[model samples]
Target: MEFNFGWEMLLLFFAAAALAGFIDSIAGGGGLIGIPVLLLSGLPPINALATNKVQGMAGSFTASMTMIKKGVVDFNKIWFAAFMSFIGATLGTICVHYIDVSVLDILVPIVLIMIGLYFLLVPNIGDVEKKPRMQEKLFNTTVVPGIGFYDGIFGPGTGSFFSLSNIALRGQQIITATGNAKVFNFASNIAAVVVFVVSGKVVWLVGGVMIIGQILGAYLGSLMVIKNGSKLIRPLVVVMCFLMVARYLYGKF
Candidate 1:
């Protein structure tokens, strides 16, 4: 198929990428924005999804670097999780062609609503240090692969999922969770994007431009989150989760 994107679509792509990157870097629902924007821009369903993956990877990569420099993450410890995430993502990407995630679309909103409410009402939920129930090795081996599989299957709130799981289940601090989540997210994205690219499902020209916006926006978001600390990131996460819930509901029914 011949590829073509007009000026209006180009503008929207950049705008969506910037906004999604900002939201994603801070709270992790950027796909909810970027994906729909691509769909509305007139790309086919598969192409839109693939294009979004391409652009989204740029944002994830940028945030991962920024958080690493800030000492918010320890890659050496999370390497196992990251590797598992890649495998999960590859599996998910392969399944995307065969399975429809319509049921997951219905479930995401309900899950997000609960998550959003928790963040909104509970202060210091993720700020405090706590003991983990599972050993690090076990959690990394099990939970990371589990979440990565889900991410590949239905990827709306992967970042938030990772963050909350790490804190609630593994007893990591919020900043650390978010930072570690980005690494896993990047791994997942890399796997998915490769599948899309190999299948010729991306609009490289448009995706390339969108990636520029995503990179800049991600950098800004990382800076903002770092400056404000968990206090600011918490509320944004709540709002974005709620938005994801609404969007998922709208898409499903």
Candidate 2:
């Protein structure tokens, strides 16, 4: 598809994608920047979403690879979760064509607020790994798929959900959970990108430019997560969750 984006608009999108990648690599809500920027550049909502997926995939892949190379992600433990998440996202994408997601418009913001508050109030929740309250099998089968479905259906805080579940249920340290979260996030993103590609909605030129920014931003953000650990991730997670809540509320009302 041909787009008439001015040079200034292109630069704005590049900057936005960079910022989105940085935030998403840390806490996941990159769409907040990506989708809006695409819309502002005059694309329709569906095209914007599809194009955002392309850029988001770039960011997620970069972050996931960085975490893996840094030895922060445990591939053996996350393989099952990643597979389940991919399947769940594919199903969710199919379901979106038939189901009314407006129900989530109200529910998701409430859930996001609660999640943000939970992290904010609990001073030391994700500071260190704890004993598992939920088994790996249960978490992989239930929590992983559920969050993946949510990402496919109505994505905003998927990363935060994954990280929180890993910490609260599976006894993973904050940094470790964030790293593992990227694995599943990448899987789900790939699933979404496939659907978008088939539908022919992706704007390759714009996506290509944004991807360059995504790569650089994702690399830097992953490094921060590796070095700062929970000290950096916790606050960012909380902030992103609240931002998601505000974005949803704005969209709804």
- lDDT tens string, model 1, 1-253? 7668788878878988998888898889999888888887778898989989989999999999999988888787788889998888888877877987778765777777877888788779878779997888888777888778888887888898888888788887777878888888999888878878898998988898899999989989888877876887898899899888877777657
**Residue pairs whose backbone atoms clash in candidate 2:** none
lDDT of 2 by residue, 29-62 (tens): 8988999889978898989999999998899999
| Winning model by TM-score | 2
TM-score of 2: 0.97
Error of 1 at 152 (Å): 1.2
Alpha-carbon shift of residue 151 in model 1 (angstroms): 1.2
Global lDDT of each candidate: 0.85, 0.88
Q: Candidate 1 regions off by >4 Å?
A: 96-106
Measured by lDDT, the strongest candidate is 2
How many clashes in each structure? 1, 0
